[model samples]
Target: MTIVLTFMPFAVGIMDNDLRQLLAQVARGDRTAFAKLYDVVSGRLFGIIGRILPRAELAEDALQETFMRIWQRASSYDETIASPMAWMATIARNQAIDLKRRSAERLAALASELDETLADESPDPESLAGQAGDLRRLGECMQGLPNERQQLVLLAYRQGFTREELAERFKRPVTTIKTLLRRSLIALKECLDGAR
Candidate 1:
């Protein structure tokens, strides 16, 4: 059996206005609305995830896991808290952060592995496509950021460095690093239209 996917342009904007309406339907167990919602938001969600997690491969993994969580948690979205996109973005961001922490732990154990062991070299097409999508999105967001802020955010999140570590590298205080991260997030959220 073969699986096929299609790309559509700027369709998310058309559906975003109706997202709450569709999600309300989804909460009521409407399968059709769920399908429509998936079609509309998947790419936009990928874009958001790509910006938060710099590594294309890791971002792809996080994106899938994020959507899976969304599938299970759609009913939990409350309009009073925030918009649907912001709610969904929060879910994805949490998932990406969790994955980052886990990856750090996993990498810590790699010292025990012998260099003589062969590495897996098989190229996965799906992974490649997912990564390409992430890269495209990341490139756009990176371009949108001021050069300095971009570097700060990349150093902190993409490199998985602590604020203290970033501070040491930049010769700034840890409080400065934290402030930068907070400000960077606010700016990006504004650029991405208040996505959390």
Candidate 2:
């Protein structure tokens, strides 16, 4: 059984040969080998996709697309240029980028359609001004945070990183990450309230 240590830092190790062999077998349409390969690498791939895609459903779709591409392109695996995991990770990252691009394009098209339909309607200037003021206040509050706290807050909220994921990335305990986030959020709230 392959022990998948997905949260470990990336390091080229002896498992590359085994992964290469698995890819070769998958290229030949070996279902068992493909299953084994998925079992070994899917956790790491999911984590990568999650970090990129933010939304869980989108990340799940990207992961499915990544595996589909892996099955189709397994024959192109070249161990000489990069490790097997590296190649697979590249495919997963590209898949996430493609998904993000497609989503952006779809949103842009929808926005264009909405703009055409609402061409006669004007946005309320008072509401817009209020929104701008709120945004400015929020930005100031965020800027007041220390750099590390700012990064942690942005990663947790904007990037959708879980506490466990932050802990792993920061090499800290999960409880510590939670406490830091709590303190940072409280500070931000206080700053925003004071600004108001």
Candidate 3:
């Protein structure tokens, strides 16, 4: 299906108060509140995502990612900085961009796109096998962490977010961010080392 994406002005003030209340409840780990928030805001967020990714499938993927991030990072939302929808819109936009970049990079890097194998086309089978195995094992290790910690790890390592950025996003002190990251890395190392 074709998806036509366009940027349009969003109506404000109507749900701002309720959204703030819902976000507060979500921060306290109320799943019902989260569900309400989703029901209230998903359409607008989807529109925001669609504006970044024209393809229906890709926009849908971005919308899912945005909500997943919102669910994971609810505790970090601060009403002082921006309105609830604004904060969520930023997340949706960032996720859409990330998804778009990944899609492009994957397409460009696909082995199937290559006409002929060259010396630099890819690593040898042994190296590729080992790398894939290591990645799988690492993913397994990451799954052992709590969801919040897992998101923090991904933001820090995969997205290259600075400690300051993490502290701001997570609403934690820099020292706390450092401590948590260190602890998480140690746990991952332990898991990886002990798995074999």
Candidate 4:
């Protein structure tokens, strides 16, 4: 199989047995062996990740993750069951699928949250007035939030930034981003209720 990583391509010149030898060396904590394996396999892994994650940036990220996993889990490889390339490709595919699912979930959260608080489309004057008032209160509450938190919410909801992107931009962990969003929503709910 051919291996293409980002702009550069690496040929899979080594045979399957050679890959198994590299994996064994990697399992023994041979850094040089690991480096050799990476140079040989990264292009193929990137290709595998790209098939699952259409975005080039995400596929790049996934490729990095796949190597990290392979590096850590090389000792677990069973050549008797599957070839080394097959094993690594499986890791790349799973990592991309996980990234895709997580991004989708993060993107969906705020839209669903807003949908739950939104008024029905009955078009009644009184309901329209109440919806307008609630929307105004939301704007006010959002303004009351700290600038960073406000940016976080607006970026995630309005600009459609994913949790990973927010973490990178904010220089925080993904867990921290989730906690901040949850706390911000709680604060907004309290503010809205108190105003009512």
Per-candidate clash tally? 0, 0, 0, 0
lDDT (Cα, tens digit) per residue for candidate 1, span 1-196: 9988877664456556699888878888888988887787778777877887777888999988987787778889887898888888888888888988887665544422311222356568868876775566666666777786788888866677776788898888665566566666656646555321
RMSD of 2: 13.8
Model 3, poorest ten-residue lDDT window? Answer: 110-119
TM-score of each: 0.47, 0.56, 0.53, 0.54
Better of 2 and 4 by TM-score: 2
Please write out the lDDT profile of model 2 over residues 51-102, one tens digit for every residue: 9998888999999999999999999888888889989999999999999999
C-alpha lDDT score of every prediction, in listed order? 0.73, 0.85, 0.83, 0.85
Model 4 score (lDDT): 0.85
Residue pairs clashing in model 2 are: none
- Model 2 gets an lDDT of 0.85
Query: What local lDDT score does residue 111 receive in model 2, on the 0 to 100 scale?
Result: 44
Candidate 3's displacement at residue 69, Å, is 0.9
| Deviating ranges (above 4 Å) for candidate 2 | 1-12, 121-196
Q: Which residue pairs in model 4 clash with each other?
A: none
Q: State the lDDT at 184 in candidate 4.
A: 81
Error of 1 at 140 (Å): 49
Error of 1 at 121 (Å): 31
- Per-residue alpha-carbon lDDT of candidate 3 for residues 127-172, written as tens digits (9 for 90 to 100): 8878887789999999999998999889977788887899999999
